[model samples]
Target: MESSKHKHYHVHDFDSRQFLENYFSDKSDMVFGDDTLKFVIDNLKQIFSEGHINGDILIDLSIGSFIHHLYSACEFFKNIIVLKVNNRCIMELKRWVDERTGAFYWGHTSTLLQEKEVNSDHFEDKEGHLRSAIQHVVKYDLDKENMTDPLVLPPADCVISDCLLDAISKDQDDYIRYLRKFSRLLKPGGHLIIIGCLDTTYFTVGKDKFHVFTFDEDFVRKALVGEGFIIDYCNVKKRTAVSDLIDYKAIMIIAAHKEK
Candidate 1:
């Protein structure tokens, strides 16, 4: 991982509305909604299209308060588990998982995936499948050695980490350590899908700012390869919108497997 000393923002609070507006509102207005989100989904969809993804458990450990990324992988796994270090984030996701009244509109994501499949009428079925696939949404604490802490988890078939490391980690070294933690949660030969903020150092959420550990594609590849992973797919897309909320120059997605 690459290292650089910079101003790190304090993660005081998390708001669902603010989070969505900053990242997922629209391409023209937001930092992530337009081309950025699609590239992420497209890379995942590419992996899903190649088959061999059937697994009993898929862990969404990315700390994403929304299910946009899961829209692509949920169909490939029998069970989905979401882990987050923030209580507010967990609550936000729970509200959506329970079919609460004011959940974000994720219809477009399902529509995108539906267009890829031959049977286009099963969009509802996909939603139902995802609701069923997500069996657990638990609290996580990155500061602890055992991220799960008191609770022990069964070996995961795949672990998805997206824009999470930079959110909580203090530095690039810490980021690498947390990655080892993620690898420990997976079984040998299991998949590790990571999405990163390429060459970005910070992001704003609500009133407080959060630090993003800046790194490039080379560091990412070397980090995963050093961890005994064979990168199957990797891509990076530069950010389109310019805003203080987003400080990253690009977004990256990687799909790799642990060596058995």
Candidate 2:
């Protein structure tokens, strides 16, 4: 594929609202509702409830203004720091965090998560808890040696990223390089949970097409191992929804720990 044919996320201006409406909305036509959203929430709930992932601070480096995955995380981590590469995404997230008008409604996503909980609380309580847990929403530059730059962040107890590697990476080397950066944010033996689509080259948000680096399950395992992470759990689900917006062979969720 020619690099000129597709728009890179690093250089492009992504419409956070359009992206959310396209995939994260509760509409029946939203393809990623079950494949990506539900799958990630389920895995995260199980991972956090399992008692192995211990952490005071969790750094989230997910793509877009997504917070559904973090709903389960807030229960385990005292502080959640979200890192975004796009300013629009940061503002979008802040809208939700600050309870400002025009924020994307996440009631549906919260309801999905509540169903998985043994003794789930009210939806308002869940939303409130998640908002409180989010301590910071900061911008990061992957090209910089220090991704967070002048704001030198403390070593996190856990780092969770969703679909970020696929969106930013131009190739396998780029994926591995970002993985190393993610690992560097963690303390030795800290957990790292990742959720991403496999064999996807591009995904459309509204009229704009964005690049998505295609890779297989074997490559992910090898990459994580090479980055000094011990894989504890991995689950791959075949794509069931047929959609023109995105073409992904499968979706994968991985839970690993940095080697001590």
Name the best candidate (by lDDT). Answer: 2
- lDDT score, candidate 1, position 37: 67
Worst 10 residues of 1 by lDDT: 1-10
Please provide, for model 1 over 1-260, each residue's C-alpha lDDT reduced to its tens digit, 9 standing for 90 to 100: 12333333224456656776678754355646544467777788888778855588988887458687887788788889899777777777787788899877667667667777777876667766787889999887776787777988889899998888767677668778988989999988999999888887666667755667778899989989988999998888877866777678888888899999
- Which pairs of residues clash in candidate 1, taking residues 3 or more apart in a chain or in different chains? none
Model 2 spans with C-alpha error above 4 angstroms: 1-4, 122-124
Worst 10 residues of 2 by lDDT: 116-125
- Residue-pair clash count for candidate 1: 0
Which residue pairs collide in model 2, if any?
none
Q: Report how far residue 15 has shifted in candidate 2, in Å.
A: 0.4
lDDT score of residue 164 within candidate 2: 90
lDDT of each: 0.77, 0.89
